[model samples]
Target: MDTMRDRFAPVMTELLDEDPRVAVVLAEIGRDGLAEAARRHPDRVINVGIREQLLIGAGAGLALTGLRPVLHTFGSFLVERPFEQVKLDLGHQDAGAVLVSGLGSYDWPAGGFTHMAPGDVALLDTLDGWTVHVPGHPDEAEALLRHAVAAGDDKVYVRLSVQTNAEARPVDGARFLTVRSGGSGVVVAVGPMLDPVLDATGGLDVTVLHATTVRPFDGEALRRATGAAGADVVLVEPYLAGTSTAAANDALADVPHRILGLGVARRELRRYGTMEEHIAAHGLDPHGLRRRITRFLDGAARGGS
Candidate 1:
């Protein structure tokens, strides 16, 4: 199965061929995959060398001219490095672009902390009116990419990751899909975190909801899963821990609800190791998820915080 990043070039190529208004901007990252696209559409496919800020600025400039721009880079450089450009050129100026990111969080642990960006979503959360898509599989990524390109001047972020689930869940790029149903609680799995969340919640009486488009948050779907009065909800994300807890709390503010957010911890692991080690250290593996999810539900059942 192809990774999400692997699907980007082909999808973008198709878009560039079909839509004359669609353009791509890069900062010397993932240029090899898009070389053919650049060859075919030299003016549309732009490479601004290592200038991450220029990449975003160019994309925003394209957007200002009524062209849809898709910007590509590692999550750290894509969002963190050019954040001011993103906030001003895009958000402030009302210029929309599709920011497609690779190497989510710790996909390449060997690349060190500089390459990791677990806080990308959280930082974007500070801004308003941005749609974020964290697809679990390449198929979903391709679909969301197309959706964003055709979105007509809406700010969108497509977060691509090397860490993918064994299978792709059907994602409409808008609402959350209900994977499993139960009465105990609801387990909302975002992006690639679905498989592990399913494994962790197996045999346990809890509803499992798969989320590919996380920006909208899908509070209605979550409310339906947890019932009107509210109940325990565990959020298993591929990025920062407790990232969506505030949104969950606001969604359930009308009733009594307990939420346990689980994902990559804020604390950095300085020792270089495999990505699996990073995942384990962050307690995102199935075993760790099961332990934490079970404990949280058990505690909630006992009327504890």
Candidate 2:
């Protein structure tokens, strides 16, 4: 399956060619893929080695100088490692950069927690007005990248993971699109979480709503989807568990709500294995999601035991 990260490099290269002001700053990730772009536009595509902090700071500096900058690196290093830079430089300084992060959550399970970033989105949410986009497919990633790069000074985060959906869907603003509808409850799928969520809720009576842009969440659209169904929402994210629980609550707070938040575990499992193993350990696999969702919705339907 082609990943969003795979398409990220080429799309960025295209951006570099199309616009001279478009610059890409990297920290030894995706360098090979963007080699030609770097060679052609050496001034635009720069590799700051392993200095994640400098990678972000340089991007901020570029943005401050009337250039649209983009920073790319592993999720953990990009968000967790140079977080101070992200928060202060780009965010606090009011400088803007297109942060294209790859290897989300347990995408590189063998690399262990050092490489995994289950809380990238949560960290970004701490800053003000950062647009977060988690594309389920390469096409969506490409479209969103173009949109963000051309957006001019808007802080944008495009998260890419190894897991991908079978196909691409239309990229809408922040409106939650219905993948499969039902009368039982609603399932909000974030990014790559769509495929497994669909599989998990396949046999159940539930409405599945897919969300690619999470931050600046379309609460209105979500409210419309919930309607009068008691606001039983299942938010399936690829990052830290319960990351979007608060957003869901606020969206459906007008009505009494029961939300089941599912994603990477908060506690460090300290286990290193395959991506599937890590996902299973976090209870994010299809069977596990189905069991957890059914259990929660069943209990909710019964008015809680």
Candidate 3:
């Protein structure tokens, strides 16, 4: 099985090859992978060095000139550093450039707090006309890349994980993945945490909905799922609680929801570690999640009893 980066690189290369007008923009470390893709498909790649601000600006400029640019970089640099350019040049103009943000949510341990960006979803979601997608697996990343490229007139931000899992399937847009079937409750997972949620639920009638795309949430689907299960929906994410999960709950106001947000307190910097370690430290691991879900269900049952 190919790593998420390996699978995505080739698909992206193919997409660029298939479309003559599409240009690939590579930033710093992400440029290494893009370089390999460029070597295979030379005409479509553009190397922009380490300047994230300039990279996004160039991508936006290229888009204005009838070229579809796929800006690639780490999530933190892409969203935080070049936000002004993304907001003004991309969002304001509706440039339609595909912003591929890789290594999302504490992917690089040594990169430290300066590189850990948990708010990319929040920032991108707030932007009008921008589609924010967080693919759980490489297959979904590939599919969503194609969809974003074909979308033509809308800005797209795709959050990609560094590590790949065997369970990650190819999917498009904001569609959710049903990980378990049960009558107890619905556990909505965002990002790579879907695997753990499944493990925690075991034999319970807990249905896990893996939300690959955070923005433009599937409200109707959520309502249908919750209604069908006859249980409260619990949203799990690796960022601050008030952003994606809260917004999603608001979108489906008819359904009751509980949001579990995981991140540094007050956005403070913590010890650097892998994504799993970070999640575990914040009580976002499988055991913690299981306890919370069980407690929620038990409390709900008690109220009824």
Error of 2 at 151 (Å): 1.6
lDDT value for candidate 1? 0.93
Best by lDDT: 1
Candidate 3: regions farther than 4 A off: 36-43, 228-230, 255-269
Tell me the deviation in Å of residue 191 in model 3: 3.2
Q: Enumerate residue pairs that collide in model 1.
A: none
lDDT of each: 0.93, 0.88, 0.73
Q: TM-scores, in order shown?
A: 0.99, 0.97, 0.89
Task: Give a tens-digit lDDT track for model 3, residues 1-305.
Answer: 56455655677778776888888887776666567678866666877788889899889988998988888887889988899998998888878798887676777877888877777777776678777777767787777878888887578887787744457654668677676666766777776667767776777787778887777777766676777324566777766544666665665666555544443334454677676777676566778777777787887778731
lDDT of each residue in 85-134, candidate 2, tens digit only? 99999988999999988898988877988998998999988889899998
lDDT of 1 by residue, 13-48 (tens): 999999999999999988999899899999999999
Which is better, 1 or 2, measured by lDDT?
Answer: 1
lDDT for predicted candidate 3 compared with the true structure: 0.73
